[model samples]
Target chain A: MDLSAINPTLLLASLMVAATPLLLAAIGELVVERAGVLNLGVEGMMITGAICGFAIAVNTGSPILGLVAAALGGAVLSLLFAALTQYALANQVASGLALTLFGLGLSALIGQGYQGIKPPSFPKADIPLLSDIPFLGGVLFRHDFVVYLAIALTAVVWWVLKYSRIGLVLRAVGENHDAAHALGYKVVRIRVAAICFGGACAGLGGAYISLIRVPQWTEGMTAGIGWIALALVVFASWKPWRAMLGAYLFGGITVLQLNLQAAGVAIPVEYLAMSPYLITIIVLVIMSADKSRAPAALGRSFHASQ
Target chain B: MKLSKLLATAAVALGMATGAMAEDKTKVGFVFVGPIGDGGWTYEHNKGRLAVEQEFGDKVETVFVESVPEGPDAERVMTQMALEGADLIFTTSFGYMDPTINVAAKFPNVKFEHATGYKRADNVSTYSARFYEGRAIQGHIAGKMTKSNIVGYIGSYPIPEVIRGINSAFSHARKANPDVQFKIVWAYTWFDPAKEAEAAKVLIEQGADIILQHTDSTAPQAAAQEAGNVYTFGQASDMAEYGPKPRISSIIDDWAPYYIARTRAVMDGTWTSTDTWDGIGPGMVGIGEISSEVPADVKAEALALKDAIAKGEYHPFTGPLNKQDGSAWLAAGETADDGTLLGMNFYVEGIEGTIPQ
Candidate 1:
């Protein structure tokens, strides 16, 4: 029942770490969805990335290389979805579902020899002057590279989607693929690229769990975070900044509940455990009311001939 | 007409080939709650399965489905194993209690053993290691070693088995260090590495220098290692890789001998519903080697406590204990009966939080 034992500084820092994976994955899906393409294979790509990053990191003793390998592995896997849904004109929903199943099985195969082996240490980066700044420094400035990278990528995504010409073209392709095709924009090519980006982000997120968060490879260790990231995209209403907010809120509640339990809070444990999902959905649902909506061509396959 | 005659002959040959193999080999099926590579609970159970195979050689065939969820999916898996002519099946995890009972009834010929569960049927046996005995030793070591006097426990669920471990660990820890405070967080999952690691880290943040986990994963060990000077005990398996420092010791579940015995029982046609709960005494629960990280005197005392529990010279749950609400649970010098321990739902005195119902 000692409430003071729970350190607020550590809590905030942990919230960011916990949310990074979801944020990384959600930001990627936001772009894919913004392009009016729904790739449901995020969970699959994430797990494949987890093992890929873990295997490479353990072999090379470099967390950076592991992160790169993870992104590559995830993008490579997403190419399969791109080929099936784009060129083959297969159903995006079914293809995404199949991708998840394939990814889970595939990761298990790759992770066979990597089990129980720890990945190389990913040191925390303390931003020199910023990290020395009292309360904020401890809460915000001290974290691994991936935590900062996730936030930076979110900002980058927001800027790109809101201001860049490429973002406009991607969004136009998403809104009306047929019209975009008529405008001479290669709709399938935009979507394929978006899907690859989404895959790479999801991979980085997965590797975060393997190389930094849990720091070990266990089968299915991504454990539905990819699916949570998918839910986060809708929660964010396809906005990158909102995705970051939603991820932090979700991660904050998750860490907070565990903290509450340790602090001997009287709330029922079941309710506390479910609070993260409940609070995030409620807050995001409230925030995303009138102005936001899904892409017009979302989940639709574009065939230029049609 | 010639093709039809040839197909019939081929079908008969195929059927006979499978039937002959089935008759010669006794199939054993295992339904695990987590992946076999979890490096903890399921890992040990899977080791027991492998031991059964090694013991019987060509006479036994083992099949396992890992990471099976604890509800209807478990029933489906057990039913599939039974329907596929498995002579014996082991449903590991407490959540599979009812499912094991239900599946056993439908396949009376298939002997079933459920771990860490209470329910039993004529064809279903229940077997569990007395992990609390090992927990007592861990508690002694954790209590002796903690400079912060705060011991963090990561529990998988609020089940009786887990509750029993908490009570045992807490009581012994309290005996060694009266200032020791237990902070328990229920992860509510049997195996989620990320969640387990987070739980461990949160506890460490709250000043828990010694981390004890009831969940099955090595993630906590890694978390403790990162947070240097923190101590952790391996659960269900010897997480020896992190030894001599963070993982100062471990509680290992040795189910190999029991699995081999049960498989032999089924083979000998002497199988019946029985409850087997063995502690360090029977070697079902083992105390992993105490690493040099522990002071020599403290290590000796911990080993002594383990021996006393193993040789029946002492009972971890001896009386003079009170419930969390200050109600008398055991009178002075009175030991707990197996019945009460099996359905333990309350925390002993000095524990701060209530068990999540």
Candidate 2:
């Protein structure tokens, strides 16, 4: 195996592309969880966003407008879950799952006429001097705006969680929702906002795939990236910076395995192909083995009356 | 007495008017497993659907639903189409076989043509090309041209259609050069460019100088171009624009003729359920133009094999074959039967990798 065959710069650049979807989804879920609501419909929302983005972009011939439509599409679908869980007082877990099923069906129906047509691509925003810097330019400065947005969101999330008062209130609600409700904090309202935020982020992630990565809308194009993002949230112990780190780590493993196969490494391609998922499972196992980390109300449903 | 007679006459006229306006058009439906814009297999099939409309004009009306997952949903869509006056339906994926059969039992009047499937009923017909024929040509070119003996194969699924191509290509490679070896990668999907590109990259790193894919994407071609010295074959589309440096030839799936022919059969009242498998001779399995990058003698040798196959003088899966475990699979000079080929699971002698369960 020739190690020199693998270009570190190219691998890093590709890793960022692979990580963006997961990062977008994970960051959205983080805010949702911190507000004491658990939504397991990321996959559904992402797919809906994918089709909506593709359709709007093809119709309008504008990629940016397509992304906006995707975010709105995802948020609108997410509202159904919010209404059921908040107003009807339905079970959060069951409602979230239902949202996913509904999203999948609706997206398929809407995507019927949009299939086989290519949408406009997002132009790269080359950071003038930074993009020209020998290796760093290729690795960091030469990506679409969405990639930079994902990284910027990570830092913003990290700051909000560590320093902001709204973040504290959200954390308080997640930890003790009944107490927060008694303190005049509208528990349902806060959770609803967080859910919408999560939905929009997942939509952006879906749009990233449709607009940048594959540059065409295909069925199930997210390919369980939402699940990976959910796992990243846990693997990072629900911390923003850790989530970013986890995403890149997972992305790196994926990139390396492919590079290894391309470089003619004497390994079975199946094993290499399965490595990314296997590594994610292993990381989850290690993180949960000690049982020392994880949010207190990670999967627990909060009841206002209780 | 005059008012009652006038009301009765008006009601009868209104009923006749509604009946006249309800004339049905010839409704045709398509069920696709992947999104139509996959730029490969599904895309080619969809193009055929468009061609049918262009040929028939006002005589036929068409509609399709893409990304319909295989299994229960397929049955639902097929049933819905049948109920909605779909006189003809095309299920465009192998996994839709059982669903097509089940739905065919219910809608005996609706004609169903399933792509790359074997099972058939009174209303259902199976149609696929001998794609392995194109793969044989690719293997001959790769075998003669490769600086490295390793050839990469990006397989979509382990189903018989894909496996046959792998075996046929390997057989040709072995015949052309005894030292040629195949490295296989299964992406387990028909169209995921990210994964397909990754699979290609892996193979190239492992010393594969030539790459062939059974998956639906131009990703392998893109990856080969990026790698610079590698060569590849386009699957299901003529991706020559990305070729010469990397993509030399392609296996184009030309469904327009088959589609047009089937619709014509329906119009002429001669449609029957039969399995149709045509290759290069009939232009069903389109072999793209061999690029100028290929050596003159190498191109000649590849064309010789292509001509023989086209003329029915050469069979890619001829006898004296053995399974990967060294067990004889076919008797000397005995070609594989359609039944065996349809259910192929074993690898040929030259393949070093095992098919995953």
Against the hidden reference, what TM-scores do the models get? 0.95, 0.74
Q: Tens-digit lDDT track for model 1 on A161-260?
A: 8899998999999999999999999999999999999999999999999999988888888878999999999988999988899999999999999999
List residue ranges in candidate 2 displaced over 4 A. A1-17, A36-159, A172-220, A227-306, B1-23, B319-322, B327-334
| Per-residue lDDT of candidate 2, residues A90-186 (tens digit) | 8888988888777777876887765445567678899999999998999999998989999999999888877998888888877777778899998
Worst 10-residue stretch by lDDT in candidate 2 chain A? Answer: A291-300
Write model 1 residue lDDT over B1-357, tens digit each, in one string: 999999999999999988788897989999999988888999999999999999999999999999899999999999999988899999999999999999888887889999989888888899998998998898889889999999999999999999999999999999999999999999989898899999999999999999999998899998998889899998999999888778999999999999999999988888888999999999999999999989999999998898899899999999999999999989999999999999999999999889888
DockQ of 1: 0.69
DockQ for all models, in order?
Answer: 0.69, 0.23
Model 2: per-residue lDDT, tens digit, B123-147?
Answer: 9999999998998898888888788
| Candidate topping TM-score | 1
A246 Cα displacement, candidate 1 (Å): 1.3
Query: TM-score of B chain for each model?
Result: 0.95, 0.91
Top model by DockQ, which number? 1
Off by over 4 Å in 1: B1-20
